[model samples]
Target: MAAFDALPGAVRDGAVIVHFGSPLIEQRRLAAGEAVVPLTDRTLIEVAGEDRLTWLDSITSQSVARLRAGDSTELLVLDPQGRVEHAAAVFEDGASVWLIADEADAEKLAVWLQRMVFRSRVTVTVRSDAALAGFFAGGAAEARLTPSAPNGTPLIWRDPWHEVQPGGHQYAAVEGHPASDYAWSVAVVDDPAALTAPFAGALAAEALRIAAWRPRWSNEVDERTIPHESDWIRSAVHLSKGCYRGQETVAKVHNLGHPPRRLAALLLDGSDVVMPAQGDIVLAGDAEVGHVTSIAMHYEDGPIALAMLSRRAPVTELIVRTHEGVDIAAAQQVIVPADAGATAGVPRLTRLSRRPVAEDPRNAR
Candidate 1:
């Protein structure tokens, strides 16, 4: 609150101030590489040991065994049934593997990683002293701000969502993915107070993410979320990685089946000037089909949202009902189509015996 109050014209969203007034202008500045955002909502966890990389490799969805120092990647911890439990942006210095995640899940994720350490040489520690900042421009701001990380490498995690990673597949079959323009990166700084420059706020960042159709663990994931449903396979989950907790469901759904739900981008009707809240019901012809997961008013796209709808939901036309019961018409842009899976195309086995035996006639008689 103190940090936000210091800003001249900030507006509060829950505990965090979402913008320093003029969110649309802030977003424009950010896209033009003229701004940076202090990511107060993120926290960092450090995993250190000779066995850190290998130990993490055995657990998470991404293949981390070969992660080189200064390289950036992300990982997802899934339940045995393949539902997303935790997500982190990962990078490593020569000594420690850093996991940056939502502040709400930082301690919980640290505790969980510690519990799984067992006899491994790995030690999990939360680095509460450190803070994270995001810049769509690059690390040029580091030249002016406080030094990042102890090693002087900035400990930056470059986003890989702009393109398909090795051993990964994209479920969104569009000719060009909107995420191609999402050039984003975050730096781990030793001091948050050193970041005194005017920075774009969370709302500005979120609008760009929504416009890109990118999936954020905080917004796009639910208790039952699998990578396929949100089209997260483009970066987070390694398709050919060795056995992990949820590999079975991940493989099964990707190779032979489709996710129960698919993500869609919705362009909302702007006549009401009302934006639907998260969990607002999404309807098709008066029947409820899904609910909005994230909503934002983009600088150029106007009001837009990302929704997870049942595979059977109609693709073209949709409607969202606001908390006031006013129905806002929406047009659906498919992110994950109904027939998104079955990529492996495993050949179906032919019937061994086409002719039926003169079945149990003797027994019937």
Candidate 2:
């Protein structure tokens, strides 16, 4: 981060590079696969030993036990109530399984993983020495550039949001989602200075992610967020997988009912020149329905954001009230459709059936 931050025209937010003073240009370069962004806000964890993949499979939501080397996927750790706890990109390199998670979640997740390893032949360690560089390589030649492998395989985790995996489900009702073609991946390196590609900042990278309707851990998840609400089940969850901590709730909510809330993308009104901040109140007329989660300025899409709206929130325009008292008119787009879940074709009984039917002696005659 220090080396990348020292680059010319680099403007930073904390340890992260926001942009090289020309976000629009940097966004263009990044979208075209001509630039790589240093991911200072991400951290790596290595789970090594013979039981690594099987242990991970037994705990997480993804079907990872049989993952072949060089395979990439994502998984979510859920609380007992099916709320999201931790999310990460998973890659198998034969020697170990690398989990690239957000900086805010890495430490806690690693600690939890350690505690869960009572007799399992696995060692979970934080790879604090490794740094990540993100690139948008959609099967391009630029994607071939990779760092040296530490365990007989390149440490690159390609994102799996382009399409739903086996045993996964999508909630977005559209025929084609913008993220269906999104190609983003991260390369692990020991030093940030080792990358020679043109640099984009975290801001540019975030804008592209938001534009693709991607749900990230730090931005989209909250204490009560379930995978179904953000449509995370599309990639991070295996619907047909064996039992795990939150499997009951995951199965129930997806097959029997809808999530209490759904994720929505918004196109904000740029007339105010002030963007709504995270946690800002979103409204349907006078009723508060949701709060803004992630906001960004896209090169082509203008101002955009993602929010968690209540199931009661109608499918119409919404109002985003900023801290400065500016009411930004936002047009809402559905990421998770209203009819997302209850997919299982089971014969559901109604409450009326639970009531005792009246009996008459004359009926017996």
Candidate 3:
């Protein structure tokens, strides 16, 4: 077994791994014929009933009506006003459907769903204890990527790099299937201690994820944010789907107007010091441009951060203003903006950008 000795203890406990390299490796080997990794900081919500898919599709931003027993979709729950309430990986089996969401908000989402079950035949429950894991590295590894819990189940994951790059890599949750849409086979290990025991000298995967510009649910989303503001519609929002709670706002802002805020990746120069704390103000000149969502010290790229800022802020270069009012030099990489219009055939204008944007962490290209 190829133990992940380079992984950190926190990650081994229940976190994802983000391995950086000078050049992306095409192949990696794993022990037990399964490359197991912990899906940390996430929770799973179970919805069981005959109308599980119907109930979800009516409330979320995706077309769950089309999802079969062995399929999954990236789903986003919106506030009545169209702001992001929560995001999840919605998967279905013959018997039930599972929603994988942020650990911090899984219970909240589950409760909300239960409240909405006024007359539906659906039942909602929190299954965060049900572990989620995956693995993939080289080509044609999809067949080997399977969830350990159930055999022959369909897996669904947000295609981390859908807009910036297509088919670069595939992410999905598996239940019963022998394999998934990844380069390596993966499984959910009940033994967190044993599973993470072999990894050595690795930092928290959250740091790598922050550097990658991947927007996690808890770290990146909140009530103040809309799906478009977070660039979530790219992977989570199914624009063409039928009416959901926040569909009107999503459609209007996306098609005829623009979102108030945009998500950016900041390049911080920390050669002189450590990175600033989260919620620090970012400035352009004297203008309060935005606030940092996540920050990290990259192994190769130095200091970097993800932020949601006003649309008028500098798209090329910006500055991070510390609480003490000291300004640090930084460059902005606009990953997901409200202005990017919808894409064709994919069912939404979430990807309608005026020009090519920078590389997003989810899809490093």
Candidate 4:
């Protein structure tokens, strides 16, 4: 921890780094694999026991019953209504399952895991001793990094957002996904001080993520958020996975219905310098269509943000209503298309047309 704080021009909020010096410079270096960011906002949990894999598979939104050691995947915990509640990166080490989630969700997810261990052999424990460091683990940088092998299996939860996993399906069908080239990953480390590379911060990490159209839980989720809305099914939710808490809604929405909302990216007009913030309203003319979930200033893309929009929202240019009651022009980039669902193509029974009878003279009198 002291090693990061001791770096030149380091700025921090509590234990997390805001930026080392320049967020843009750090972003460039981080993207090129010259830097790593200490992920203090992320926490870890260990689920130990012989029944861990099957137990997790029965409850979460991923197919993890046969998860092999050293392999990486993510899962989502959903409410009965199928709204996203918790999400985690999963890694098994033969002896136990390791879960990495945001600090905001770790404690609750740990407790829920423990409570769900009725007859199962699983025992859940939050690993206060572990932490994360994120970087683009591509090329030589992946080789130089040494991930923790505490149980004789290195724990590196690689990001699978670049492509759809085996049991997963993608609702996002862009011509060229920005995330296709994103090789972002996080390594479970014994200590943040062990790293020797130049460090970036959360700001830089987030900018690159927003530019890539990545839907991170902390920013993208609300009480009403479903896996389909933010296109989270691309990585987190398994379409054909066996029964889980919210599997019914998951199957229903995918096969017969369209997701009520979709995720979109807004490239705000940088001319006015009014940076719209999270929770600001997105307006299609005068009606509100969506609200911003995350925002960032990319090195090459200028100002950008991710928003959860109504499925019927305008596909054209919109206006961002800032917190100060100012409106700024924004160009929309669709992440999840409006027609993103009903993959089953089930035929709908058409309604019969009703004949309009002539108005009664008695009603007019």
TM-scores for all predictions: 0.92, 0.94, 0.72, 0.92
Candidate 1: tens digits of C-alpha lDDT, residues 1-365? 23334555657777465887789998887777666677767788999999999999999999989888788889999999999999999997778899988878788889889999999999999986666777774434545455476654558888888899887899888887898978888877665665665678899989998998888888888898999998888899999989999999999999999999999999999989677999999999978899999999899989999998999998769999999898999999999999988878577676857534555476554
lDDT of 3 at 119: 91
Which tens-of-lDDT digit does each residue in 1-365 have in candidate 2? 45455466777778877888889888899898888888888989999999998899999999999987899999999999988999999999989899999999999999999999999999999987687888887634255456548987888898999899888999898887898768898988755665665788998999999999899999999998999998898899999988888999999999999999999999999888798899999999999999999999999989999999998799999999999988999999999987778998997687875754555455554
- Compose the digit string of candidate 4's lDDT tens values, residues 1-365: 44345556668888778888889998998899888888878888999999999999999999899988888889999999999999999988889999998888999999998899999998999986676788897644456567888899988888888888887788777778898888898887765566665778899999999998888889999998889998888888888878889888899988889889999999989988778889999999999999999999898998999999999998999999999998989999988998888888667665545423335565563
Model 1 local distance difference test score: 0.85
In lDDT terms, which candidate is top? 2
Write the residue-wise lDDT of candidate 3 on 1-365 in tens digits.
12333344322333444432211121122212223335555677778888888888898877777667756557778888998887777667767887877677888888989999989999998865665554433423233344444535544343332232221111211233112232222234444444432221123344445554557677677667877675666557776767889888888777667678887888887765646778898888878888988876655577788888987776667889877776788887766653554432344465656535554565556
List RMSD in Å for every model shown.
3.4, 2.5, 12.7, 5.5
Clashing pairs in 2: none
lDDT of 3 at 197: 27
Per model, state how many residue pairs clash: 0, 0, 30, 0
The lDDT per prediction is 0.85, 0.88, 0.61, 0.87
Q: Can you list the residue pairs that collide in candidate 1?
A: none
